[model samples]
Target: MKKLIEVDHVSNERVSNVHFSLMEGSLTTIIGPSGAGKSSLLLLLNRLEDPDKGEIHFKGKKISDFPISELRRNIGMVFQQAHLFDGTVEENLKFGPSLRKKWEQNDGVKLLEKVQLSEEFLTKEVENLSGGEQQRVAFARTLANNPEVLLLDEVTSALDMRTVELMEELLHKLVKEEGKTILMITHDLKQAKRLGSYTLFMNEGKVEEQGETASLFQHPKTAALKHFFEG
Candidate 1:
């Protein structure tokens, strides 16, 4: 597979000398304890926060070379808390694409279906929806941008188990059918193992270990990783 984003010695106040490549159309889970900089690392991916040192390349081109607006449009982010605007679900879905003059009449409906929500949700008030439904709307809104890569920061942390499972299923479908690349930060190791093909284990702002999820979980190479699994 082609490399989508390449990180070389990237660092910030919270994230340290991290190096990795996210392959196209792959879901890579970043797992670590709290304050290990998992969320900090994700911020740098979409230029939500820039690395104080090192470089990030998108599709073999320097990330800085791309316009920030366009870059963020291509790389969408979904946070743990779904922050919806004070409006209907359709308005939330149309927000991003409208800014770029790419909004379509049916975009909202299409995105809702993609996230496994029905058409009726389009007219529902975002604030009236349950947490899970709101999150699904958030995902659909992000998808409306037609992003190539998605940066998910503990998106399912506040969700119920069933909602989390549904989100995982939707994510897998997105990867398989749409070939969207995903880099997700998840504290749940079990969720990582279930959804991720590759996993990055981090600690104290550094990458402790990384490899295929099955191999790394089955045979942790470092004491830290072993302890994490054992714990």
Candidate 2:
């Protein structure tokens, strides 16, 4: 697996001295308490915010070298809340691609199906959907741009257990079948262990531990990580 994203000595107001690499076709989970810079990291990755110090490289090139539009299109992000516009699902799905002039008539249905939504969802108003449905729509909307990576921020935190489980399944399918590289922030320890091939443990805006999920969970090398798991 080639390195898809490399964060080298990155620092910002919320995080400090951070470094990590995400492999292509991998699903890596970032887990920690509030103020751990988990969300901050994602912001930098897609250039929603740039790091005050250090650099982020994607696919062996400096991220800053790419046009902002192309950078964001390839590194799509979905926030904790579904930030959809007041429109039908098809319209929302078409929003990104249409802005880039890449929209095709069949794009809405294809994007919906990728996120496990049916073709019928294309015509439905987004406001009429449930929370879980809306989140899936948001995911599908991001997919409309055909990003190489997906950054997820506690996307299932507000959902029911069953819906969370189903969302987890969808994420797995995205990585395993659709070949997306994902970096997810999750408050659920069990979900992190279940979904992430690799896990990054952060504390005080720094990466305290990172490794294969099974090893990181079973043999935490730092006291903060051990306490995190214990508590």
Candidate 3:
């Protein structure tokens, strides 16, 4: 796998000395308590927000070398809340590719299936759909672009147990089938281990512990994560 992004000696207003290298076409979970700068890390990758100091390279090139619009298009993001436009479901899904004429009907339908939604959802209005349904639509829209990386910011937080489980199952399959390089941030340890092959545990704006998901959980490296579980 290629090293898509390298967070080298990064120091921001929120975090300092955060360094890590993320591989392409692999799922990496950023696990931490709230305010650990995990979301900040994701922002750096997409260049939505820039870092104060350090080098962030993508595909062996500096992140700044890539055009912001083009970089964002290639890295699809799913927020905690599904920010759908005030339109029909079909219209919302068509928003991105409508301008570029890149996304297709088959791609939309395939993404809908990946998110475990029926074709009937395409016609429904966004306002009428439930939270879970809306998020499924958002996930479908993200996949519409065939992004190399998927940044999920607490994607399952507001979802019900049933829906979260369903989406997790679908994401697991998508990673293997599509070779998606996924970076997901979650407070839920169970969900992280289930979804991530590798996990990084952050505390006080630092990566205190990190390892394979199974090993890290079973044998935590830092008192922070240990206390987190014991408490």
Candidate 4:
């Protein structure tokens, strides 16, 4: 397909000169050590934090050229924590679209079902749910926009393995069938390999190496890769 996101020498003072290109209709994993700027790079796509000197383009249009509302709606982001407001689950889902965020209840619920959550949870209070449930709700909320590009920041890092599996299955579907572009930051290489077809192995805020998931993990290119897998 086309290039959905083009990040060239993307450097915010907080981050480093990270260079990468995420293709359209594909799932690309951003893996690296702590403070490697995986999450920072995710934020840059929507200009959550501007790059000191670099350019980001989405669908051949400069990200800087997009209006805030238009840009955010097209690029949905899920943070490390499940940040649900103190309200019923449905309210949280509704809130995003109600505020003119790009979303459709029908399509969003389909995505939610993949995450293994029922529509019944919609009426339940968000705060009462467990961590896994909260993350599921968060996933539904993120899909509220039906974004072309989904930015996931270690979304399952806090959940247990079972919860992680559910989230992984949902993400896998998004990448494979839904044809949505995804840029995910992950600490777990197992999760990365399972969910991402492409991989960008980063270290100290730069891409040390990148390739297909199986090849990169099976015959890792750098010493950093060796240390990362060993540790």
- Report each candidate's C-alpha RMSD, comma-separated, in the order given: 1.0, 1.1, 1.5, 1.9
Q: Write down the worst ten-residue block by lDDT for model 1.
A: 107-116
lDDT string, candidate 4, 93-162, tens digits: 7766878754565754565576788767777898899988998888788787678899999999999989
User: What does candidate 1's lDDT look like per residue over 1-231, in tens digits?
Assistant: 999999999999998999999999999999988899988888888898999999999999989999998999899999888899998999899999999788888888889888788999999999899998998898888888889999998989888989898899999998999999999999898999999999999999998899999999899999999888877
**What is the Cα-based lDDT of residue 138 in candidate 2?**
93
> In terms of lDDT, which candidate is stronger, 1 or 2?
2
Clashing pairs in 3: none
| Alpha carbon lDDT of each predicted model | 0.91, 0.93, 0.83, 0.83
Q: Itemize residue pairs with steric clashes in candidate 1.
A: none
TM-score to native of every candidate shown: 0.97, 0.97, 0.94, 0.93
Could you tell me how far off, in angstroms, the CA of residue 227 lies in candidate 3 after the best superposition?
1.5
TM-score of 3: 0.94
Candidate ranking under TM-score, highest first, comes to 1, 2, 3, 4
Off by over 4 Å in 2: none
How many Å off is the CA of 76 in candidate 1?
0.9
The runs of at least 3 residues in candidate 1 whose Cα sits more than 4 Å from the true structure, single-residue gaps closed, are: none
How much is 100 displaced in model 1, in angstroms? 1.2
lDDT value, candidate 3, whole model: 0.83
> Which RMSD does model 4 reach against the true structure?
1.9
The clash numbers for all candidates, in the given order, read 0, 0, 0, 0
